[model samples]
Target: MQRIHNVTQLADLDDDAMARCYAYPRQLDRPWVRANFVSSIDGAFTVDGVSAGLGTDADHRVFVLLRELAEVIVVGAGTARAEDYGGAHPDPARRRAHFQRGIGGSADGAPPPIAVVTASARLDPAARLFTDAEVAPLIITTAHADPDRVAALQEAGAQVEVAGAAAIMPAAVLRVLAERGWQRVLCEGGPHLFGQLAEADLVDELCLSTVPKLVGGAGGRISLSASGFDTPMSRKQLVLAEDGTVLARWARR
Candidate 1:
């Protein structure tokens, strides 16, 4: 890792090195909410209708590290479907080191689970997110969500939990995650979910990777919302990879 002012932040990206880079918060009152995203230099979060275009080896490396440190990866259903998110296939060495190194406060030793937030529970029953899950993909919904669809998801192998009444509330989502004993919440977003977190003032950190490319067209930016805020941020780390992928870490201020 390198500092924004050309100072050497770190010398390597080895296991120990990366682990230290993404170490979870030392102390917490509640779950620490963090989000990860990749974007183009033009401020586009998605290209060709997805976020895959704005990715690089370095960004992916950091992505894995963040997941390794998190105890529960919270994501919007739309992003999960778009990214083809299956169960976490954690690296054996990485998973082992995470426990041994004590990344976050887990009740017992286990890789983080994926908790997907959705209103309709329309995810496919056979989707790898469920069938091939390492940990059963948790389905978060509202009481007012379609009950029939909820039953379908429950039959589909998801542990459905009602977190709200009509619309999915951020606080309710956090309550469900905490009930599962997760203290580190990693949110991989698709705008809607991110906006909700922002609206509720729940975002603690953001890991953004800037790919060195220009994708000029109609595409989603990092944020899309009816509710927006001029939130202040503190730069925690700024590293320029050899491939010019600028990986930045910021804390909400």
Candidate 2:
């Protein structure tokens, strides 16, 4: 990968450099919500019904790197189901990278747990999220969710927590994760969840990868909020790949 704009002019960026560029702040006392997402050049977040088709090799690399940097990943239930979500896996190299950056690693060297936000608590108990996870997922749902479904998820070994009454609120989700000492929070969002977080001004940073393709279909943008609001962002970093993919990082201003 190469950094083409607003940088120190590195023609080629190696793995270590890339990790260094994307590392979370070493000192974080509160949950810093960083959202990672991919979309087409025309602003379509997905090609067909799934987002997997919009990803490139460069995008995938950054996706994994973001996962490595985070303490917990938050996603909407619709996204988790559509993407066939799984738990983050432990990366020894990333742990060492964190240590080199003076940011302590997980004591057990375990992967970050995924926190799924759902209003109805309608996740599959037998899904790969539960059965094939390196760490147990935290199911964040509303208090009014179906009792039987909540009990079923708990029975399947998930840590289910109530974050709201009738709906899942973004601030409450952050509070829940913050209480668990998950300071570096990453949200792999479906648009609605991203919208809510942005609306609540809970989002701190955005790591967006733009694929070079153009899908002018009935697709959605990276965020879908109930009402429009403006939150200015400052470009932090920009990188380009050989395949024409552009990855950029934006910080809330």
Candidate 3:
């Protein structure tokens, strides 16, 4: 992979080098919050109700790199359900790269945990996300969430927590994650949760994969901004693959 705008050449960009490229910032005032998403050149976030249609081999590579670097993976229940999320299985190659770079997880070096956001408490108790987790996931919801459903989920072995009363609050979400030492948060989103995070001005970085296709469908943009709350972003790096897929890193400004 090679950078385009600045024209920086990378020799193969092997796993170790890639890990260094996206290593979590050393000094953070609070937990470092980042999001990853893929879209077509025309800005279609998905096709056929999923993001799989607009991806390339390189995109998949970056996806794993981002997830491997995170301390916890955050996602809206919609995206989790749509994608049928399960345990983040161990990646031996990534583990080696992380060890070489000395940017890996805790001493135990286990797979990062998953924290899910839901307002309705309707996630499946038997879903592989719960049944196959290496570490139990954190289910975040509102105080107004369905008590019976939450009880059912608890019975199924989930750490359920209430983040707000009428709705889930983004600041509270980060606070909860921080309280648990999950500083590097990766939010793989559905637009509603993305909108809320943007509204809260909590996103620290966005790793976007712009595929080289034009999928003409009803798909929408990667995220919707809050009304009157425009968060400026500065491009930090731009890498272009041989297949015309562009992977970009943008810091919130």
The C-alpha local distance difference test score for the whole of candidate 2 amounts to 0.86
Clashing pairs in 3: none
lDDT tens digits, residue span 1-253, model 1: 7525622233356767767777887666698899998999999998877887788988888887787778889989998888887877656566667766667524344567889998877778778887777777899988877788888788878899987776788888998998887878999897889888977888898889999998899886776667657889988877778888888888997
Model 2 lDDT tens row, 195-217: 99999999999999999998899
Write down the TM-score of every candidate: 0.91, 0.94, 0.92
Angstrom error of the Cα, residue 237, model 3: value is 0.5
After superposition, candidate 3 runs with Cα above 4 Å error: 1-11, 96-104, 225-228
Ranked candidates (lDDT, high to low): 2, 3, 1
Question: What does each candidate score in C-alpha RMSD?
Answer: 2.6, 2.6, 2.6
Candidate 3 residue 11 C-alpha distance from true site, Å:
5.9
On the 0 to 100 scale, the lDDT of residue 78 in model 2 is 92
Candidate No. with top lDDT: 2
For model 3, the run of ten residues with the poorest summed lDDT: 3-12
Error of 1 at 215 (Å): 1.0
lDDT of candidate 1 at residue 145, scale 0 to 100:
79
Question: What is candidate 3's CA lDDT for residue 189?
Answer: 91
